[model samples]
Target: MVPMMMLAAIMSPSAQAQPAAATIESRAREVVALLGGTGDYDATFAPSFRTAVPRARFDAIAAQLQQALGKPTGVAAIEATGPWAAQIRIAYDGGTLNADLTLDPGGSHQIIGLLAKGAEPRGPAAQTLDAVVEQLAAQNGTSVFALARLGDGSPRLEKARNATTPIAIGSAFKLVILAELVRSIEAGERKWSDVVTLDGSALPGGGYAQQPKGTQIALRELAERMISVSDNSATDILLFHLGRAKVEAMLPVVGFTDGGVRNVPFLGALEVFKLKGVDGGALGTRYLAMDAKARRAFLDGPVRDTPIAAIPRDLFQNGKPLRIVELEWFASPNDLIRAMDWLRRHMDGTAGAELRAILSKNPGLPDATKHWRYVGYKGGSEPGVLTMTFLLQAGNGAWYALTAGINDPARDVDTLKFTGLMNRALDLAAPR
Candidate 1:
């Protein structure tokens, strides 16, 4: 988790200074009421608003808001900034919601914009830890280590089911690189503004592929891209700069030393594809047999420029005769949360702020703010593996680390099922 000192205070609308229209608050309340009562809510929208958000989409957003915040009780506060713009706080059966609503320009009361602001309550969570554990057990071949604490205190709920065992964590391993960079910055070794040159590497996604070579990007930008979008080339650049030894040493530095997760010769996106493309499915055996130096030689030698296009698509599916356990980066749920704790404890000033800002850039789910005062999340997914980890702060100023991973060598872990489950777990663990 990024340190609290790094996060900037979220700005609220000025209440007393701005002059508000007489009907502004009532208009906002009417909009909420129309959503609850239904009929053709789209009829209230301006032409542009209707074009941007169709009736079905508007209906979906309304349903989600109701599910997340419950029935709208009343408007608690309102600050109209313009003839159309108004900031409001609404009370609901679930909790209080902060929103910004804009009425259409002209004479129509059509809603131009309706955005939920700040954090709202997720109603009440499950009372007992057993209920959460039961849900975890229901999913086969899944492991989770979830512990929520109150402002750096002891865990309120710490439950581990096969949590000590390590599994392939996909992009979640990027956190290690982030942690190492912070350590370097704090030690006077590197500055966040330091710039580095980019060499050619065929990264997996379109995120970084379009950038020209010799781009002379700063370290901070690279780190942000790596974490926020899981940019492959950005990660490889950092990996090459840090070298294999420093990354390997990170396992023990962050307290992941119980042999649950291995530390040496980390794989970049290209290298991962190379391993998956090996003939006769012997990639894991071939790579595991070599020492760190030999592995480095192979990575640079044959697979250095391996492009994403070269790898077979079927190789990614479940039961493809590949050894994901040995081939990919591994970490247990417990190991990840421990590292999150370390990051939280060490975050300071600019470096911490950079990481926190990057984390908050994730286009979040609609109900995300309802449960957390703030959330820093990074998720990793592939064919047979899925992981979601969060560093959270509650409305009452408590902190939490909630992590879950699902693996199925037999088939792909259902993405929606696991994601929904983890979302519920996060809501359940929110500070009361």
Candidate 2:
């Protein structure tokens, strides 16, 4: 819910000290121009904004915006809220939206924050956060989301749907590996620069997978690739070097609190692909049917040695999702929130800056980044599942964590639709 304080207008008729009304208005107009697809980042946005949100990202956002809003006919003159801020009205053909612009006082007065808030007849329907939760849960398949404010004490779950039950989260499990890597580094057991040899079990959709069999890669580079691109090879390599037992041990510390019992004998990316991505999930079914002890032995035996090319490709390409559930790594939205907050607590200042940087590497989708000062994100998906979780820091210095996901056993989850809904939640959940 957007509190009354957030609705506390971003305006000041007279207060002084920052930029002139004319300068603020001009910068605000430049923001509109960028949204209209005619302005460049270096000229209109602050250094920090440019760094946090890249040009290509902004371009993509603008394209999506233009596609939705039609042509940006004009922008109203902005009112200077302070030396560094203003709220402007932006008019589009289909409808209209408002933008809150913030400028930097240090050197060139470029915009640091550009929050585009447009409450359609649709979302932010001037509605509560629960509305979005209900909508997500009401989707075709089982949809879930957990919203919370991160703090020193226990997190207050502001909204939730199926947030306690663990659900399949394809690649987001990489966060577990990342947390374990950080723990190992802090324990002086490993260094980010440590090099490891790569085995030949490569998967589709990863650059590292294309490298030579014995190629050497640094731990830091592997992590970056694993997260930024969802590099299956990089993730497997890290899991191999860190040891499954250690990574599994760190799961509860990061948020799986099940003591790794549920995910016992953790399966690597190669094993997952061999089982779930092939045989119409027959292999996964057989593997998942075993007990923990038997499962471990199975992984150590046939599952580990089976090659990805052992089957005819495209057997499952008819667009049907896999039937395996317990085979993939699983977590609830609240569990992911706990994991994100755990990372945030450990990464204070330089203590965990590099680690935090890894989380902030992609920021996933930019729809939420504009409203928050810091956006650290991780998203996962397969044919039947799509999950996105974020660690957002508001301008008021308050921190928030949220995870939204859709799980359908029969169909391909709609990415764009889920993303639009998730972005709406961010817009409404954020402070104005």
> Which candidate gets the maximum lDDT versus the true structure?
2
lDDT of model 2, residue 429: 82
**What alpha-carbon RMSD in Å does predicted model 1 have with respect to the real structure?**
9.5
Q: What's model 1's overall lDDT?
A: 0.65
Residues 1-432 of candidate 1 have per-residue lDDT tens digits of 000001112233354223235456656667668657655565665665564455655565566557766787778788764555666777878766666666654455566666544335554444555666666667766656566563454344466666667877878888888888888887788998998776765665424555777878888988887876567767878877877568777877775654343656677766786777766445545777888788878777766654555666445532232556667778876777777777776656547877677666652333455789877767776666777778787898777777778776766554434554565677677767
- Error of model 1, residue 424, in angstroms: 1.1
- Which has the greatest TM-score? 2
Clashing pairs in 1: none
Worst 10 residues of 2 by lDDT: 1-10
Residue pairs clashing, model 2: 18-83
* Ten contiguous residues with the weakest lDDT in model 1: 1-10
